[model samples]
Target: MRERVDKLKEEVCTLFTPSKDMLRRMYLVDEIVHLGIDHLFEKEIETALKDIHESEFASSNLYEVALRFRLLRERGFWVSPDVFQKFKGDDGNFLNELADDPRGLLSLYNAAHLFIHGELELEETISFARNHLESMIRDSVVKGPLADQVKRALRLPLPRTLKRVEMLHYMFEYDQDNGHNPVLLELAKMDFNLLQQVHLKELKEISSAILDDTYDVYAFSSIDECRTLNAAIQGWDDTAISLVPEYLRKFYEIMLSTFREFEDQMPSNKRYLVAFNKAEAAEWPHRNYKPSFSEQVALATETTGVRSLAAGVMLGMSDAATTREAFEWAVTSTDAIISCAKIGRFMNDISGYKVTVDVAIAKINELMEDEWKTTNRARIDNQAVIPVTQRLINLTMAIPLFYGYDSDGFTFGEQLREILENLYVKPMPI
Candidate 1:
């Protein structure tokens, strides 16, 4: 395996074009880098890229210039954005003529995302290039590979998308064209297969440990397995019957189904999962750029933890009653479930000191207000919502007095597990 990879690496290096063909060479280098197999050929790529950048790089066309600038800046080269100065008109904007070139526009679309917050030209370029590229996609004016590439870029631009996800999507999208090097394509396939095996093995070990440990408590069937475990943990806390024999059986079944879902996601880049998960365009873009505290809480209700609680509620009651109460909880805001979900989300941001103990004291005080004895209890206990909601508002809004910014997530998760245990299972002895 190692020998073939070494051979393929050398073959890819040999494909690099020099001097006048430097622009062409950079295109291949960009693909190789984004594919994340560049570590194998890093020294060769660096040497070739530097040579191209130093030798007559400024004389290249718009596509070449944009691609070269993007690749160099991304690789930590100190090239100036002034390289784009030549492309501008007397009006001090990018030339109107440049919008006609799809390849150049695409390169600029990618380059714009690398802006460091204050680069005004780059910011303008993002809006300009996106408009042209998206118009092309919307109008069906372009076809074949370029059109497909446009659509893909619109969804996951180079800078913002996760590297592994990009490599996974591009792995299958990479086709050996008549002029392209087959050796590079073959190397990519081999490396992806190797990486995928590692991902699967790691996930399998995690899946096994989860089933072994949580089989006695609760298991979740309908969501991401990691989140399912979280949901099941909530179920164990939220209900006295979480340990009942029948519930445990359902828990195992749910756990098994969750693992199966993970396996299903194992084979492809998550385009399948994403398709099902994505809300329509009208419903997305989330109404607020930074979601408010209540909005975040409402969003958390859609998560597995909240739905997991709902599942237990529905399981113990008839459909008609469950639906009515669940709707009431959703509309009127069930303070207990809302607080629990908020704690779960914020636990990802918890510190061992303040957020940790604050959560404990607050939860204890909350349980004292109303005995969370039944699913319907929290829904109708209108008084419980005001105090819990107010406390939550204070905690989030007043966090700045201590941290001076939004919350910082820790390397550890759920620091108040004992507090949750007291609230959910049964109260620990004072």
Candidate 2:
């Protein structure tokens, strides 16, 4: 399997040679990404994209242009959305000829999602392309991989969809493509199965969040019990465990023991940062605390679990660059971290039934878009470690998978059961 994977990877790299046409290269890159094997060829992919960028890529064909724009923008290149202006007719609308091509419209529709703030051209592009793509699907104008892709994009475009979740979908669709590369397909399946084994092994060691469940589900009748538990966590000692309710004693032990295990594995001086299990008990006193939208967002940002999870992820990193500074960056309330938390919280509120705000769903969605822009800007501006930055980005991207498109896949596991099965329980057929 290893020899096959290595040979397949070399063949995949050969596809990026300068002799390949720009459109063909772009499509291969997109497939590599969607197939979840891009991580195996990051340097090769980067070199190819840089070469493409230096070539002053341009195209009269709508599909080629849109694909180029999306591919460039997705990699932090500042490709202007105005590149699409040529496709508009004299009346300030997209050309009727463009609408007739569902393939090109689908490309443009998915590309528009990478828009930053005030890019009205891209926004208009979304509306124009979406209408045509939807019409095409309804009219059965597209079939095979394009058909499957357009339907999925209409639900959640490539940018927002989780990579792991999309891997199996793309693998199956790519299998149906007459032009698909056999080497790439084989590599994707092998890589996927290898990763699944690692994930399943790791899943065995991960216990449920007893403390969070205690606070959220197993509510205490006495508010003082909540206070005691919070204080006990702050104390970070087994002695404080006795002060909490009897049922919570085991949770505290598990949490403290877990942190102690983490501390033992780290440098002695840095062990202090391991006790980052702070929880707020103030909300317990007022169960009916109906906060305004702003208040809800602020509270949720703190309680959304991204900060601790990000920090924990950084702490566990074996990278030499994951230094104390990187750990500090993860725990700090930077714009990037705050945006991630807000995105998670807002998505959860929008999808779950626990929403306390009366704001319209559209309004919350708009706020999420603004937050996404902030996060994307932070991705460009932040000078943190590359591994840390990538980790934060991964954390943010995974949020949409669990709480995306007005569906709380986390809470209502049925929606994601098939996805999880594909990811963890089942391996791609060789």
Candidate 3:
């Protein structure tokens, strides 16, 4: 398998040679990323994209133009949204004739999603692309592979969707494309299966542990109960276990045992960073507090669990990749971490909350887009090692999969069952 992967990697890299057309190379780059094997060809991809960027590439085709724009911006290269002005007409709107090209519309739709603040061209472009693409789907003009791509993008654009879940979806779609490279497809399948086994093994290691909600189980009536519970967690010693109610003692003991297990594997100095103050996290809700929107966002940042998850992820990585400074950065409330937490919290709230007004939901969506821009900026500016940074990116991207647009995948397992099964249960056909 290792030898096969090496040969496949070499073949894929060759496809990036200067002889390949810019459009085809960009398409291959997109496919490799969607297939979740871009990491294997980082140098090849960077070289290809760097050449593309430096070439002053331009195309009359909307699909080619939009694809170039998105791929460049996604790689932290700043290609202005102004490149799209050519597609518009005299009335300051996207030309109606462009609607005939469903493929281009879909590409533009996906590209527009990468827009940051005040890029009204992309804002307009997205609205234009969406209306036309939905019309195409309604009219049944796009079929097969194209239709599948359209419908999926409409449901959730590529930028916001979870990487692993999107990879599975794209694998099936890529298989249907007549132009699909057999080597790339085979490599993707083998790589996915190999990683799936590793993930399944990790899952089996902790399969027996089931945690019940401590607050719900205790039915604590007052803030004092929460405070007492929090105090016990802070002590992190056997004597502290006696502070909580007798009924809660067993649960507390089990929790401490788990924390200690984690501590055992982690460096002693780093163990102090792995705190989980569930009791304090629930204080706002226990008091029935109705904070202003800003206050709510602030509160959500600390309680979203992203900070703890980030710390855990960093600690689990190699000490070389996760330096002491990197760990400190993870624990601190940096803009990147804060944006990720806000994105996750807002996504979860939007999924579960029963908001009657469309405007209110729109506001939340707008906030999420803003947070994404902040995240994108942070991604470009981050100084951490590539592995550590990619893990953080994966954590941020997984938020949407956890709490989907219409349903909370975390609270309701049904929505995520198929995705989880694809990742852990179903074997990729080799």
Which model scores highest in TM-score? 2
CA error at residue 189 for candidate 2, angstroms: 0.7
Off by over 4 Å in 2: 18-20, 208-210, 218-220, 259-290, 315-329, 354-359, 382-387
**TM-score, each model?**
0.48, 0.87, 0.86
TM-score of candidate 3 on Cα atoms, chains taken together: 0.86
Instruction: Give the candidate number with the greatest lDDT.
Output: 3
Off by over 4 Å in 1: 15-21, 52-56, 206-430
Cα lDDT of model 3 by residue, 14-67, tens digit:
888885478788989999999999878877887898888888676889999999
**How are the candidates ranked when ordered by lDDT, highest leading?**
3, 2, 1
On residues 208-235, what C-alpha lDDT tens digit does candidate 1 reach at each position?
2233213222222222333343444434
Error of 2 at 5 (Å): 1.5
lDDT of 1 at 176: 27
When 2 and 3 are scored with lDDT, the better candidate is 3
TM-score: the better of candidates 1 and 3: 3
Per-candidate Cα RMSD to the true structure, in Å, reads 21.4, 3.6, 3.6
Between the candidate structures 1 and 2, which one is better when assessed by TM-score? 2
